[model samples]
Target: MTDDVTTLAWAYLSRVAEPPCDEIATLVGEVGPLEASHRVAAAEVSDALRERTAARRDIHAAEADLNLLERRGGRLITPDSDEWPTFAFTGFGGAAVRERPQGRPPLVLWAIGPARLDEVAERSAAIVGTRACSSYGEHVAAELANGLAEREVAVVSGGAYGIDGVAHRAALAADGPTVAVLAGGIDVLYPAGHSSLLHRISNAGLLLTEYPPGVRPARHRFLTRNRLVAALGAATVVVEAGVRSGAANTAAWARALGRVVCAVPGPVTSASSMGCHVLLRGGAELVTRADEVVELVGRAGEFADEEPRPTGPLDGLSDAEKQVYEALPARGVRSADEIAVASGLAPTAVLGPLAMLEIAGLARRDDGCWRLVRTSP
Candidate 1:
């Protein structure tokens, strides 16, 4: 395996290709990066793929990117590098990501700043919300981030406006390291207006991305980027988001990755809070303060480091009951019809287990419907 060739090829591909390329990631995973790079260099690719790879095969391109990163006081963090976060296990967490449409691990990461990636990723909490957020969201995000940072926990967020921006600034104000995980190239100052905030993150905390220089942010990239933010955090907290917002997507990814997920409730009449409410109803822990977030993430991190809980991985719930319980939300409620549909169980089939679950105190019935009893689990 040619390490240098592989490294340079990953850099080259990162520039030419869109991120989270499932096919390429699978190929690289099956073969080592070196062998995969050699294959692409040899044009051992399908006709459709050859065109893309052939057009971007500049042997010198990776060198230029390296030099640029060096000048910017940054470096590449590849899977082989010690700086790579371990939580990025076996490429994109676990078996769960393979089921996703755009769910693959990043090929290479471009990083700028002082905070170590693993340390920042391991104990962090991703605080994300809508870019056009309400004051309530802003306040919640800032306070939550501040509390976490002041406790010496790293705060991670995208450097967008509203909730993300507030999260970063609050962390800094607390004199704690904050990481900005960008969707675009690390060098590209997205939102253009938040250049100063990005600058502060680069200097005082950390700035990271999978895209190479000159790559601009795209709508798909931001959605795909959610997984990185989700993966970095031991727990992910959503302050507020629209019904169909990116922050909600981040929460979904966190659930898929098995990271602890939490949601901060907001006014019922506010559309900005819909996503958070949805998440809360979907079983994410409900948190309203910075201390709550810190405790949630802290216990989660501690649990992650503990010996595997003999909760038998099934958490002592039978499959049918587990299905029914999962269908119920952490807040609000779900009707039997909804639970049946979600659990893919017939109404008749669900009735018995829901009863048993209620007896076990894992679920509670309300007005003929049911919901998961709120628990730290």
Candidate 2:
């Protein structure tokens, strides 16, 4: 449990400094959240920190924000809270990640849900893609999300349309937990169309954000939000994306944070999959199925996809056997000489393979002719 003063201080910091406030973050880490709030309020911080807090430092909304949050049935999750995902966010403190505008971990999170944030994130994966997704993309996203849910991996994603919607719906359908990291305030669902979906998530899973209540979403906030989504999951999977999409941005953050990045390949002609192809070409792991994702993100040796093998009847046959099989018609019979001509094999060569095919049940002999056997429906 987090103390009231600490929560208030973090709430104030979250509102005043905006997000990814590296200077303020450093101040908080050094003096603690409560004291850092006091220092910033009294103008006792460094020049950089002062500049960051100069505008909104006078706005004391911590108490009011807390009141509104409580009214909305939400709570503030601070670093001191046991539910805070300390391990998941460890990468945000890295020197390389800190320099970027969207790299820093949130000062505090406003969340509404029943599940513990830390527990849900322990074995989670982020599934992201374009809003303008194709049907093929939708099918793949649903399958991946459903499989992940069945395996007890929480699905983390932005609660938007298209791929995000499909992922959440699939997870819910599977009766699994999910987290929606939003750009706007936790109470303010940005896309009005997803209100029902977002509400269900708040009841069953989690709705998290760095912004205080009543804050509307902006374009820049979405980019800032991507970092949290990337940090929460052990791996980030992109089902589909345009060349320059928010999904791609999230994938970049995942890579920067040293998280596994996986991309699903789509048709070369699909404009929606251009970004995933670009990622694949640039060294992202190619993930076609959910098992492959589990192998990459799950515990070591806990999961491994079986190597795909050829399933065709002629898979292990010699060239002559395959030619003979191919030459045999399904609807009618062919004499050995005709099969030989059709297979481009000598008459003598066709007889031996025909006998082998018959013994293997791949071919059926009728009087003096042969035809392919339909082994499966």
Candidate 3:
């Protein structure tokens, strides 16, 4: 199919199609996107689906997102493109062609950042847990992510609060690429608190979303996103989760995909670790470090990590973050607005980096502003 036709077709379908919809996936697969688009436009499909398509057949939003994302250094990758995550499309996710398939993968993935999606997904481990993770859960998550990073294994996680944030931070701190699978549009930073972290991931790692540019993260979207996380990675690791949590959902998806599932043991008394224990008892392997995770996801000796811990806090920050740090006056405080102008980034963008800097002990926040912390002994 022609590039223009293919792009516009998938773009339109993506906006209107409810993802993981087996019917749409099968239809598009049997007949190319261009033909499928024609079918929908001609009212040859189901009345309900045709009505849905008619309502969103105007590709303005998707086209706008394509232009905006390209300008921002990202793109929409489809099955025809080499940058596509073929494993997710063809692996367990794509099984059951003869019978009615149980599930389907995304038609297109919006990727933002420096790392290539194919490379990042090649040998990845997903670390997931509760938003209100405990200290032990947080520590184990960092250890696993850092170790995985040192071995060139890209870390994958929902870029949310708690364990997910810790996993992304640890991988970035280790100077390896990490993919943030956002539930919402890549342009709309949800959880607002992790904007700096997510921005840095997009620069040094990768940002992935199945949603359109302006789509907000709905509760259902998160559940759908967990499957992508499970499908992209070779193994899914539940660091800490409640009895019924998103981490558990990822593990379930991994198990369904016939992928390895691992869980770290937490204190028996802790509520956060209960999910991990459940997975452990339900056939998930017990893993403590990155090497174990690597072994499951890679060939022997590949991604073997001799070093497990990070060197220091500032080691893995993105260039943008480093610029923000450099812009800080050595002896005085600078408001976020001042830092934004100095660093050539927007004021809203500055807040995330500032928050991260403070967490890294490289900067401190005073009354409504920030200042660098003394590092010399």
Cα TM-score per model: 0.75, 0.77, 0.74
- Tens-place lDDT per residue, model 3, 148-230, is 99999999999989999999999999998899998888789988999999999988999998887888999989988988898
Ranking of all predicted structures according to TM-score, beginning with the best and ending with the worst: 2, 1, 3
Question: For residues 248-340, what per-residue lDDT tens digits would candidate 1 score against the true structure?
Answer: 999988887777899999889999999989998888878877666666666564333433333632377756677787788768888888888
Looking at model 2, the pairs that clash are none
Off by over 4 Å in 2: 87-94, 300-377
Worst 10 residues of 3 by lDDT: 300-309
- In model 1, state the lDDT of residue 290: 67
Q: Which runs in model 3 stand beyond 4 Å of their true positions?
A: 51-55, 88-102, 299-377
Judging by lDDT, tell me the better candidate of 1 and 2.
Answer: 2
The per-model lDDT (C-alpha) reads 0.81, 0.87, 0.81
Q: What tens digits encode model 2's per-residue C-alpha lDDT throughout 1-377?
A: 55787888889999888787888888888989989999999989999888988999999989999998887788899888889885434343367666765677788899998889999878899999999999999999999999999999899999989999999999999999999999998778969999999999998999999998888999999999998998888889999999999999999988777788899999999999999999999878788877777766765222123333456776788667887988998688999999987876667778999999999999999998998898763
Clashes of each: 0, 0, 0
Best by TM-score: 2
Clashing pairs in 1: none
The best candidate in terms of lDDT? 2
State, as a TM-score between 0 and 1, how close model 2 is to the true structure. Answer: 0.77
